[model samples]
Target: MVAYHSSALDGVAANPALPTPLLLRLIAFDGGGHGPPFQALHRPGLPEPAVAAVLTHPVLNARVQFAMSGQADAEQRARLANDSSPRVRAAVAYGPEWTHDHRTKVRPLPDAVCARLLEDPEPSVRSALLDSRHLAPSFLASLVRHPDPAARHAALRVWDELTPDGRTALLDDADPEVRRSAALCACPHDARLTAALLRDSAALPEALSHGLLRRADAERFLAEGVHLVELAGNPSLPADLVDRLAVHPDDSVRLAVSLRPELTEARRAAIDFTVAPHAQEHVGWVAAGIADQGVLRRAATSTHPLLRRAAARSPHLPPDLLRHLAADTDVVVRTNLAVHHPDTPEEVLMSVYARLGGTFSAWMATGHPHFPREGLAARFADHPDGIYRQLAVRDPAAGPDLIERLSHDPDVWTRQAATRDPRLPLPRLLEALALPELASSAGANPALPAGEMAVVMDEAGVPA
Candidate 1:
């Protein structure tokens, strides 16, 4: 036997290749015999050629793989469809390069591959395929059947691309997201589909249901009409709704309707059932819109003060009615007529003033531009009532002579009113203030007698 001494070989070697025996021994040291093959293909400074050689090398090719998911270049991508490693095959399945047309190239991944990936112990890979825009429809359908809510949501997003029948099938989907998407994505123009959606109360979101019910164009559905009925049934329905129902033919239904602008004449006439003061007041107003002067005149005598007042204020009230209301026992009704009655005679107004003293006369005097100021002033001067005298003095229409005469009037309010007269001259103001009796009274009561003092002081060059 030849003795191969390692120390002798190291000394003798000078760029000599490894001996055949040594080479075999080194190759066998690697379990798979792949070490020498890989080293040969991965030599430094020759990257492209080395990689190509490794991909094709008989011994190393079993460990190498490429992604062939899909691409416009079908044949090139399909060449790696049978790649050994699952990672490389999954890369092919989700490769960005695989556009819609490239999907056909991936024809049939093995059942094992599909099932394993579908249940992919890894969620990320499964999710990518589930959400892929270019995913095959058949594959997506299969995925939707998986017991995953996320997969169903993803499938629903693309339901519109499916055939009409396919979309209809999703309406019964176990997942609400899928069902809702089906309802919303159904062709709005298709009345059948819209009706179907409307019928499935379970599948609708509250907002979407409301939107459909309120849709102006879908009037044929009578959805709004139904809602209006529901609103009528609501015990908390607005008073306006009851007012609307007041005229409804179905007395029962009418009770549900509130006050709306669309109330019919007959319906409005039916509101007479309401005897409450406020209800009567509103009815009187509504009646004024429809009733003649005769009817309003009758209402003006209504026991309810508000009804009487409304009748009195009616612009369409006849002259005869106004004359009747001018003598109303209710001061408010009388006052209303005094201020608003266009045809009320001057005599009737003056009579109202004389009978109903206080601010009633003042209100009439202020509002009626044609009120007889001289008559009122004379009445004030002669009348035993101090309030009448005060009202006459404050009349803007009162002449200066009447005011001057009233300036010396015995009543303090009468004199105060006279001083307030914008027409009262400076000399008269000073004279009224300087009188011993008037000056003493003016000093005693600051507010009542202060008016003449203000005028007199202002005329005397005193800062007002």
Candidate 2:
């Protein structure tokens, strides 16, 4: 008797071109290293063999079957489909010639083969089937019933093409992923299904529930007045859903109700009540659709600092409102007014500088594009804060005279700032440097000199 082992058969089965008859003979020989049990062997480079020889050799037959599957020959593929080994038969199942019609033509795969392969023993085979562009709906539906999450996931991925009954079967699927996928695919086609999914408090998992709520909210907010009114009239809407949507953090929702063409005055008031104060500005801006001073005034007076600041910077603020905010207590409001208020009077601007000190003064002293340079120069020169003096010295309006004046000011920061002033002439600058009391007072000290020091004058460019 031949004495080959299972391991030798595996080696031959793995080699596509290995002869099966020799492999079987080796298996019969208990894996002895000698040649085939049958001594008559075809050598290499032979022409096509008889069909009998090909069928008798398992390894050669598998190779022939694999080759026939690759060919356009349908008869050869059909003949190989009945091969005894599941491995060979499985190759035929995957072969290109095995169309949807061939599912029954091939030898019946074992239930375990279908079950084990439901997840696909091979990832390439599974993934190819999962992603098959041309898979028929009937074939896909059958695969969907396979007891594997992976196969179900694949079927759910293509669920859009399934019949209504097929899609309905997946609704109660054990896998939440499958249900969620179906929900997403179904939402666009069937409003009743979407509403049912959304309304089924327990049907949706938390993540999908939140996603659906947000999506529905967004869609409702964007819908026309007629549709929104229709949805609002639906008695089925949960009270919590209504309240949550009414007080929704989105400004657009409030604005939608506020500006709805069909809204009664009472409804408008209710929307105003539901919207947070901060969200009102968006409603007002959209309602006006143009710059309106009344809106600006209301926003400026709002208790919300953000609204107040926004109003202070609004292009829609009237000239009078700009004038009023020029002296606002909040430096940000005043600064925004200073920067944006085209009609801000020079006196109001000066008051803004005087009242809003530090960076605000510095901001004003650096000439605003619309403000007169002479007024800004005067403010910078006469600014009570010494920093503004430094600003003045740096100003183009500051000639040699102003530089001379600032260079000897008791405030060291002002003096130091003056020293770097581009407008300070070399003669006045040199004279200022010669004054020991002015230049020798630790010129680099960050602290400004106290107001009590002598004011050094150098009209003739004299060292003090």
**TM-scores, in order shown?**
0.31, 0.31
What tens-digit string does per-residue lDDT give for candidate 2 at 316-374? Answer: 67666676666666666666566555555565555555655465343653355444445
Per-residue error for 274 in candidate 1, Å, reads 12
Best by the lDDT measure: 1
Candidate 1: which stretches are off by over 4 Å? 1-280, 284-306, 351-361, 391-402, 410-412, 422-425, 430-464
Evaluate all candidate structures by whole-model CA lDDT and list the values in order: 0.47, 0.46
Error of 1 at 325 (Å): 2.8
Model 2 weakest lDDT span, ten residues long: 452-461
Each model's Cα RMSD: 39.5, 30.7
Among all windows of 10 consecutive residues in model 1, the one with the lowest summed lDDT is 7-16
